[model samples]
Target: MKKFWLSLLSIIIPASAVTFEDNDTVVLLGNTVIERAQKYGYLETAINLSARKKKLKFRNLGWSGDTVFGHARSYFGPPKEGFDRLKSDLTELKPNVVIVCYGAVAAYDGQKGLTEFLAGYETLLSMIQSSASPREIVIVSPPPAESLGAPMPDMREHNKRLALYSKAVGKLAQKHKLQFADFFTTLGESKGLTDNGLHFTPEGYQTAAPKLVEALGLSVATGNQLQSEHARKLREATVAKNKLFFFRWRPANETYLRLFRKHEQGNNLKELPMFDPLIADAEKQIEALKKTTLSLK
Candidate 1:
């Protein structure tokens, strides 16, 4: 049964990785799993490497400690408020592709929350599809925390619970006829990939990001592979652009801006829009620096 599932997964996602088209806007959404991806830059770099002849834009709208119901995004409001916020944000970003990661945090409730998790997951999926109508959706199962030496949270049981959620995610992907990336099986229980067992190290993200690339039927290449003085400059420019966009997408001090106490500091929201010009400037630099195409294999 396990072998059958793995084989099925390869056919749907990793094996037939979705080929990105020209001018595609890829959005990464979820909890800390996706939020932390911005820091490493591996995931974005991998996707960019996969670009054949077109430039792609990426937006990271992940919130730390969020659940399937947008818990973290809620910011002291009801989960539905977070969902609405997500909807509003997506309406603004207008991404044609969305990558979703959730489930790990919810698994904290163990087997007891399985049913609720499944129901909530279904609702979340519908909401996402509705928000970004006609967009391609890829679901990523939360990678299990490493339970090896030094990291002691008795994650063995957590892994067991995660396994169930992973299976459910796979089934949901199949049922919806969408792509699914099983991060759990690929990086879960692996050592050296995570620093604190729960969070991934930079190496871990580089390793894991490839799995998604594979699922998208895309090859991997690193900035180092582009051997040229200009390529180096372009890589740095890309990183700069990404950083600027990150601030625009996920600004700090949400407590006073869009969250619970937003009323107190709502006036400060003006600063958030200022990132737009900086991001545009950085993007122009990246475009000017892309003098050569990467040899993505």
Candidate 2:
């Protein structure tokens, strides 16, 4: 009888492992914005949020400075060992949702032709779909580039061409019945949320994160700060240190530190000049955290 029970338990354990292995995974592929997500802690933030919500596993496969065509070309080159490596990577991961967010580097005229670009993109998507059998695919449009530094002659034309390309991608999404996120429409304005013209600032991600959550059909729990407690504390300390070290604004540092601490403690509403919508969102997030804490008890 004891032997029978042990055998049953062993079978059950492996079956459970198989079940967990079949759980959904989300893959994000893009350029520096997506890569910076992991570097600057936004990916961590997304993971925390997903864990709390019991959503799909999130994976970042962003390659810095890589455009769609560049990545495609790399798959055929000695560097990437070509298409075989890409196939192997995708097969091993077996993601459920694949989010594609490239085109910044491809926006350059010398590197892009609309016909060739579309053909390559289509082939890539078809290959992934057939090989990996992911449940969904999401194509994200690149945001408008800024005009801060000396403007290139092709800058405006590049943006215009990319916009057309985005529209074409959207059409493909419709044809394929895939999910599409028009980030350009959401983040195109000069004053929308970018720090530089191209790369997203923390504030930019803050605005974009919620929209992404909504687009993905994840639960929208308001009031919980997007960042972890440790990150929040570190950010506060860094701000304080910078003020004292670089600017020598001791009095302002004290005030800023006090406000940051107060904000951390969920006791303050006074806005600092540095407090953007992202910080505002963080304050709201604290409220959500408090509620979750109480509920857990």
In candidate 2, residue 151 scores what lDDT?
Answer: 52
TM-score against native, each model: 0.83, 0.60
Worst 10 residues of 1 by lDDT: 7-16
True lDDT of residue 134, candidate 1: 34
Cα lDDT tens digits, model 1, 1-297, are 346345434533343476577778888888987888877666776667677567677788888898877756765666688778888888788788888888888888878887898788898878877777736888888887776565366667677778778777778888888888777776534567777778878778767776666655577655455445655566567667778887776677877887678889989888988998888787666655553546422
lDDT for 294 (candidate 2): 28
Which candidate comes out best when scored by TM-score? Answer: 1
Q: Model 2, range 1-297, lDDT digits (tens) per residue?
A: 235323323321110001112246667777787766644444334333534533344455665776554353242246544345456657867888787876666666433476676676787788778778887777776665654555523245556656666566666666776776665544444444555567778776766665555444444334444444644543343233323222221124433344445445333333333444443345345334433532431
- Give me candidate 2's TM-score against the actual structure: 0.60
Q: Given candidate 2, what's the lDDT at residue 59? A: 52
- Model 2 ranges off by over 4 Å: 1-22, 43-52, 70-82, 110-112, 149-157, 190-196, 214-220, 227-297
Reference-based TM-score, model 1? 0.83
